[model samples]
Target: MSFKITDNTKVYIAGCGGMLGESVYQTFTDTKCTVKATDINLTAPWLSYADVSDYSEISKDIKSFAPDLIINLAALTDLEYCEKNQEQTWLYNALGPENIGLIANELDVPVVYISTAGIVDGKQDVYNDFDEVNPLSIYAKAKYHGEVFTQNHVRKFFVFRAGWMMGGGPGKDKKFVNKIYKQLKSGQKELFVVDDKLGTPTYTKSFAKGILEVVQSGLYGVYNQVCNGDCSRFDVAKEFVRLLGLEKDVKVTKVDSDYFKAEYFAPRPFSEKLVNLKLNARGLNVMPDWQEALEDYSKVFIEDLA
Candidate 1:
């Protein structure tokens, strides 16, 4: 399981407008690899506009790029939105991956599909790559289907499951960390955070780096790529406030899940933490701790607040 990417090797990344896609692009840039970034909403000059749901478009792109690897990062991750729009969610999250897998399989290229910890049953204390997935939400179910299709259709594929992703994106990121940062920066002094749900907070950059390691190793299977430790939403908010030096004035308050039930009515796994035993056993490095990654992210966005 060892493949080398020289300067001449072409790499294609789907859904390049998202935070993870941005980080993946940066990682590839650092490695000096030939990369083509694509997304349906290609606002940036670096991305090519294409809809993955259209098999013709996907096939055309794969044939034209002739990439050594195709990384599918496109997914509909909004839990509530997906709950309400089940058809759209399934089309984008599940069907898109299946299309990409088919195209990559035809081209004889390895495909790397990004899945989520949400696919796992949160009732479990901890989940590994071998754990049976029992998705609780539409978004999770769609992503789980994508994982299954990728594994079945693509002979060479790596499915990476991540949790509570955090990183920089123009308008693609709307996760817990970004929402809290927005609230704190908009002159909000008080913050109410859920303390019940628990999972690892993954930094997109570290997750991207881990993906590169896996690709280089040429291992074709599922892996959990997330930060080293687990914590609640309240813990993440507290750490964010601390990093911004606003802990004292921010007035962070911990609340039960029922308090925000109205806003987040979608079903969520109470615990989506994933164990990195497989990655560690294979000698691949796990991501940094959430606290450490948050500090780095804070340096970029917190400065704007002041």
Candidate 2:
């Protein structure tokens, strides 16, 4: 029994103001699904107000919409900020899911929870869908806690773990791609990139599309959803510079994680590379290769550059 997201389907999305949420909102609305997207930061007109950490407020909004599905895209993702604010991190990353799960359970509807590849400790070269997750940082611990809660408590749920998310372009991309681009855009001739940290680059467009496709199958379980391949921070930076046609102008220098240790002091895995084994085996994987996705994604930044 698959849960189909038809034209009549109503989706209640929380934290719908981030990079991934932008794509997810577009994807779902394109399908003619009734989407009630909410977030604390109402950047777009289509979005309303709702804080995922606030149980009563978020519950009121979802219940009012009476959505057939609930998608929680909310999380305190800043590693350093999370390290400094453990209480807030736990509230949003952990308890938030529990709140949504309880509501979904009451509504007897399916729920979608977006998770992170950073939950793993980076001990291995790559992680599969069922790999042992040893969360290293406050962010990872809180996120992993949410993942576990959804798996154990939620009756009907789809937990998709995304890797190094790249989307939302210049305005919304808070991840690696935007950070590198900002440096390049600032007329910096030399770019210092880390060669140690490695992960699959999950494009938000592909990831959102993957979510829609996976949910349609009605397969309710946790899946390691990432791009086709993996690379280090250095690989991503070099590639982005080339894509922006700045290879000649900008020099990408490879450095170890120690280079940014003072700034990014949070504990991060050496490898957050996730293999979409489950999604592939189930024939539900729709993620493009990291390079291909990056090339397409570069157009946004290129346009911004011009």
Candidate 3:
């Protein structure tokens, strides 16, 4: 609750090309802050090449930036890929935070590390900041380690755990929401959605704004940054079809986990419904409801439906 993120306050981002990262960069930039965004892919011109797993490679530039705060947004987000490449996942998800935490120690800057809802086994109804984590996949385990490292090493940190992210519109969206849109766009008549799974689907822009506000305020700790409400994957797809006016055109069929075949290589928790209990209690809840966020997100890509 000590430092407040201000406009033109030098800031360095480690992963700014992804959906959430893009949202953060755009939102903070809109505030007229001195922002430098970096990514491994270098997909955009504003993004410079930086790998979070290797601190030595990026430590010099990061030090040179002299940022007031460093937000480490880098991670191996692909669950299946993480399962297949365990070592790489560990390096990026776990060691990545550790590497940046070390740098933050030297520079004495607070770090913002994005954790995942995957840390839990999904056996319960909803998870809070106080809930014990039981990661199922390699990605989840590594991310849990990332949170631990951040909490243990970093002098000051904000660990945000995001659930079922929705954003990155056309080309960048790789999550469940965009996946359904792509299938529908490809002229799939019947979309097989997993009804068994349940989680909160969050919009990236809303999360971006929430994180920025938190960064600017005195609240810093673990926060569940998902949209309000909870539902299954089937419900989300149905909403997509309804919002797209494709309910009449596209058929949303409910299916279990087995329907995915080999697509789900890593074992996932049956549910990952994270509640913003702490944020709400502290009056820091800034994200909107799931339905509202979905409507807004759909409006952004309404052309895709057409």
Q: Which number leads on TM-score? A: 2
Residues 262-306 of candidate 2: C-alpha lDDT, one tens digit per residue: 999999999999999999999998999999999999999999999
Q: lDDT at 157 for candidate 3?
A: 89
Candidate 2 to truth, TM: 0.99
Quality of model 2 by C-alpha lDDT: 0.93
What are the C-alpha RMSDs, in order, of all predicted structures?
1.2, 0.6, 1.1
Q: Which residue pairs show collisions in model 2?
A: none
**Candidate 2, position 291, lDDT:** 97
Q: What residue pairs clash in candidate 1, if any at all?
A: 1-217
Span of 10 residues, lowest total lDDT, candidate 2? 1-10
How would you encode candidate 3's per-residue C-alpha lDDT over 1-306 as one tens digit per residue? 556666758889998889888898888888787999999988688999989888898798799999988988898899999989999999999998999999998999888999999899988989998999899999999999999989987888899999999988977888998888888888899999999999999899999988887887756688988999999999999998898888998889999999895898688888999999988998888989998999989875687555
Residue 154 deviation, candidate 3, in Å? 0.7
Q: After superposition, how far is residue 204 of candidate 1 from its true place, in Å?
A: 0.3
Q: What is the per-residue lDDT of model 1 for residues 205-236, given as tens digits with 9 covering 90 to 100?
A: 89999999999998889998888889999999
Error of 2 at 83 (Å): 0.3
Candidate 2's displacement at residue 91, Å, is 0.6
Stretches off by above 4 angstroms in model 2 are none
Cα-lDDT of candidate 3: 0.88
